[model samples]
Target: MPFELEVCIDNIESLSTAIAAGATRIELCSSLALGGLTPSFGFMQQAAKQSTVPIYAMIRPRQGDFLFSPQEFDLMLADINAAQEAGLSGIVIGALTASGEIDTKNCRNLIKAALGMGVTFHRAFDLCKEPTTALEEIINLGCERILTSGLAPTAEAGSEVLKQLNELAKGRISLMAGAGVNQSNVKGIIQQSGITEVHLSGKGFRNSLMTFNSSNAKMGADEVDDSQIPVTQHQAVANVKAVLDSLS
Candidate 1:
């Protein structure tokens, strides 16, 4: 099979871009700025309406680590049920103990919530105590795939570990290369690691369409969040997909 292109999208507009560019799947989230959070129900519903590709909705409730309190964990469960009911292709989720171990019970609870839908363990795997152990555990839990950078800062740098994981997995589960995957290096990562799937945000900057900008107004709590908005460009996505096709 040809390598699959999965694009991370944070809104309805980005979903449009993903479809226009012929993405194989969608990892739908809300706040890409905070490394993606669970999206609003309205936004997700709109995505379901607009997106042609299957969406793997991010099931996080906040911006921090995978560890969640009881209430937060309950909320995540609710999000999972809602995401599956909302017609997303799969649920992307993760939870970990402070010791950097998989929160097996909670993860199982979440998997049950899916009631047999697809699941992808997200980058939280990168923060686990051990990748090989976690891979076995995730496969046991019936997750379809895992998105990781192999505990490194970027997937390219982590390709060797990714290769090791591919060998370890032996087709039990898919290892999706993400975090810094692009057209330039995507073919190399796939060739080196033997991972046939990838994830990325085909986002490009665009100035906010505001005639009169408020100097003091700011959406984020930062020094300067210039209105150079990050929007998904279909051209970038198509180019990356083309590269993957060529290699295949």
Candidate 2:
């Protein structure tokens, strides 16, 4: 089987780059620096129009913890509706209980909202109290795949646990290793973890086009730096895709 390369993108430029570079899937989001918030409805619609491969809209409601209030859950359901209306092929979603287990009830509701579209449990899996228990819960929740880093900071760092998780999954669902994945370490991650699918941003920094400078003024949060924009590089994605194709 051909290995799947899912590119996580936060902007139209990166979206076009990933597609042009041979990405098999796209995870649409915004503010990837904050770990990816839900993309705007317009963004989703534009991505659906541009992507030939499947596009999965990230359904995260906010930037903080996965534990969400009832209102937040309602917002997620609305986002799912927007994804469907936008003609997206899938949705990436995850929610956790206060105690760190998968929020099965809310997750089921989200899954039900997604209905005909594909569903992937996002990296919130890494935040669970127990990896093994979380795996079973995710499989039971009916997600088509789980985007995880084996409960570690990066896929390369967690290859061993990823291998264990892959073995335990037994084809019940796909385990797509993500987090800090790049062209350099992607091959090793696939070999060590035995995962057929991988996720990455393939991002590289570029200075903004604006010639004017405002050193004292800022448009975002205190920590935000608008000088350099993070955009997915065609060469970066193509490099990883080449590796996957070679293994195929």
Give candidate 1 regions above 4 Å deviation.
Answer: 223-226
TM-score of each: 0.96, 0.96
Evaluated against the true structure, the overall lDDT of model 2 is 0.93
List model 2 lDDT by residue over 99-151, tens digit each: 99999999999999998799999999999998899999899988899999999
Best by lDDT: 2
Which pairs clash in the backbone of model 1?
none
Displacement of the residue 33 alpha carbon in candidate 1, Å: 1.6
Q: How close is candidate 1 to the true structure, as a TM-score?
A: 0.96
* Count of backbone collisions in candidate 2: 0
